[model samples]
Target: MTTPTSCAYCQQRATQLCAGCRSVVYCSREHQKEHWKRGHKRECKCYEVTSNELLGRHLRATRDIRMGEQIMCEAPLVVGPKVAATPLCLGCHRNLLAPQKPAMTFYKCSSCSWPMCSKECEKSPFHLDECRLMAASNFQSKINYNPADPEGKESAYCVIMLLRCMQLKRSNPEAFARLAALEDHLKERIETPLYQVLRANLITFIKTVLGQRDWPELEILRIAAILDTNAFEVRQNGERRKVRAIFPGGAMIAHDCVPNLRHRFDDNMRIIFLAKRPIPKGAILSISYTQPLRSTVQRRVHLKQVKCFDCACERCSDPTELGTFAGAHLCGKCKVGKVISQNPLENAANWHCQLCNVKKSAREVLTQDARLQQEIESLDKTTPVHLEEFIQGHRIDLHDTNTHILQAKYALTQLYGTAPGYAMDELSEESLKRKVDLCEELLQISNLFDGGWSIFRGNLLIDLEEALVAQALRLQLASECESKLKRAEELLEEIKNIMKHEPEEMQQMLAERQQILNAAMAPFSVGVE
Candidate 1:
């Protein structure tokens, strides 16, 4: 017999509640709906559910979150041990630590006296703009100084946000001012959320709880929030959606081996999430927030050490989970067999099939993949000009849709139109058509993987339309060239629609393509039958 709790909004006995924020509760579905409508929307986390010590804790919804909706927009809480940072506290951005040894020395914050690990870190380009402001502030607490520590290690989430803000400040002052004024506490901490949180909590804890104004624990938490927020999400260009590394707030979403959501970033650095599959109500929505290519043991180890969670997600619990997706290969002996896991976590495996018996270790497959990747990386930048052989070599080891292979194909597509090498002007008509076919094939895959209004798809369409026009012109048939030109116009219209938001860049490309199209049509437009 458990006691019923009251809702934070309407004061009714609540059974269903949020698990993250724990600031609100709900009596029933109807009450929850009514309360949500009345203005509990922004701070409501009713959908999130997690257990603390096995007891369900309900958190309030922070905003009226739709399915696959973004609930909060946060800034990074800290900056960096920048490859180029002047002696600023990566935690507070104060000129605290100083360089201990100039040659053996990494730059340390003059104020905090904390030294970074490397000179490159001391010279991070991202840290340059902020160094001046940090230096000018006299490294003292002003009315604008809100010094609050974050919940854990410096939040990479906050640090990255601050860096973006600082960059914005340099490029667009009005926008920067607007962001700075968004929260009063932020302004005091030089518009840093990590500092505001730390200041508020540290002040209260010291005055009310411990009767002290400062604590080392507070500083540690501030640093943690900074690290959590500032970490970068590095990814390749054509990945349908930008994939960012999980930051602090994002990292808190928890893990499920069978995740419900997938996320990608835009060029502008906004995080977007999609429903990988339909999720029912009361379901705990989750995203992997990590590299899906890693093994269970590797993933769990990284998550535990870096994120402080023991992931018992379904993928982690099963030995063969994710099907050892990252490390699978064909069997050489059987020729028709696939390698599989005997124990995925332990990296022990055997390759066999229903018809034959064969075996291989995880190490052998991983080493092979690594070797292939290294070789692929070693190719000269101009290799795309010789796309046929490049693609053929990749096919030997990498799957058609593997990220690296897809990237290579994208480069090949661009080269078909732009490459000025021997392969370009010397291309045979049949060879040119083959290149067009390859572009079409790759575009179809791009649509499947990253089709949500992507510029890559638009560019591919533009290139294909141009190739078709060229093919028609070469035939020296007026009527046929005109028809192909019409098709090119249609393709351009489609590109315009997708690129409406990027009018300048799209217009420039459109203008260039139109000139080429006009030249192709000039011979057809003259007086003729």
Candidate 2:
């Protein structure tokens, strides 16, 4: 865990990491001198790495923590590409740009022919160790970028992160030890289909092609399983560029669907975690490993598949899904009734309608739900007609707060402001009002599950604020515009509080948003939100 540095004299946040010992920090040179005289000279030392297995390798607070306080900031031990449906740069993990013309080929590394973004990425330190081994063994990448495939097919990217972890054993023994010590769940994984596939393909390829024969087969597989258990999906600007990273301190936090801790990555790729709410002393810090908007069944399946545990958190056990009813559907016999799982903790249990008390088998519910999801997925999201039609058609079977409806509504909010035919300025008064209704209703549902400071909530507030501003612009009366502008100001403040610890890209957007609101309000001599 990191020891946050403070200014020696003034006790303000430190902005400089010390050069001499690479340990302490100071806000200014004068404070550094004062601190050096007052016990810093003798006491300042490099932080010692420590481990605890008190709760089987989870983190604990050494001191009292307040809301929005940064507990720890850590650099990733290893960073590499994820198993992606889309082709991505092995180094940066951005979606690979498809060749404009048919004859052009995808980029590859000069040394090993592995997929990479450019010549600069071909020489990255992270790629060097794996590149050397692959080149030495005469291995070449078969991963190709296909322009026609929206999700570019590339199965070979899966092995890149695993290869990087294996190379650490020889290149850096200390990091290798830390990597080995993480939980692997080898007992559970060996029986899984993925591990079976790895045995047939990945294991044979490494030994026969890449020729790392000296490394034990089980150990190599164990490292891969360990990464699946603990590695964080690190990304900047939310969805823009994503890669897997292992942060020893940050990984120790446990999981909760409605987590009290929120995290963000810095420009240097350091994980910075802050309290999402007022956490008491000795409370175990946690972060959500799954999406907040997903229903209990969805979250449970994802957690069990990836993290290998069935969550029984407060929100997960509640049948109403923390009152959002994101998974609930209307009864077939009685349209007034809402159907929910009888026992949320057990996946195979029965579901019953609340008003009519009619029962349905778990298999029946699962199958029908999947069909609906598939039908929704097939809709073209670029325009609003199909989605609007879907909502109208399913109104009897699925309620307003059903998961598929919520998903469609979220998509429409984005489409309204930027879709080809529905730009904000081009929207009719009725269309703008429709957008406001969707945002406000979704936000109320969001509060039940996502709560105050979640990223889901932050994004919703942003959409709502813009809608409110648009409504203000359309209104002719002074009293009506005043009401809309005040509500917009309220939402703007909430957006800042929620996204304060987000990435630099998000921060830039926030700054620009504030400026736009300021410029709009200046004509009325109003203050900044």
lDDT of model 2 at residue 27?
90
TM-score quality measure for candidate 2: 0.84
Candidate of highest lDDT? 2
RMSD to true structure for each model, in Å: 13.7, 5.6
Report, for every candidate in turn, its global Cα lDDT versus the true structure: 0.50, 0.79
The number of residue pairs in model 2 that clash at the backbone is 0
Candidate 1 per-residue C-alpha lDDT over 1-529 given as tens digits, one digit per residue, 9 for 90 to 100: 2334887567766767654334666766777678778877765443453445411232223333343443444343322333222333333333332223223233454432234434444455545455444455443211111224211133222333334444565576765454443212212233366456655664453334433234344443433343343344533233221222324444445455455555544444445444443445556556554554344545665665544445766666664443333334445556544455565545445433424576655676557656755765676656454445666865544445444555566667777756665254556787568668867876676444334334556678877877877677677667777887888778877776655544354578787878888887787678965
Off-target runs (Cα >4 Å) in candidate 1 are 1-328, 336-348, 351-355, 385-407, 420-431, 454-507, 510-529
Q: What's the number of clashes in each of the models? A: 85, 0
Name the weakest run of 10 consecutive residues (lDDT summed) in model 1.
142-151
TM-score of each: 0.48, 0.84
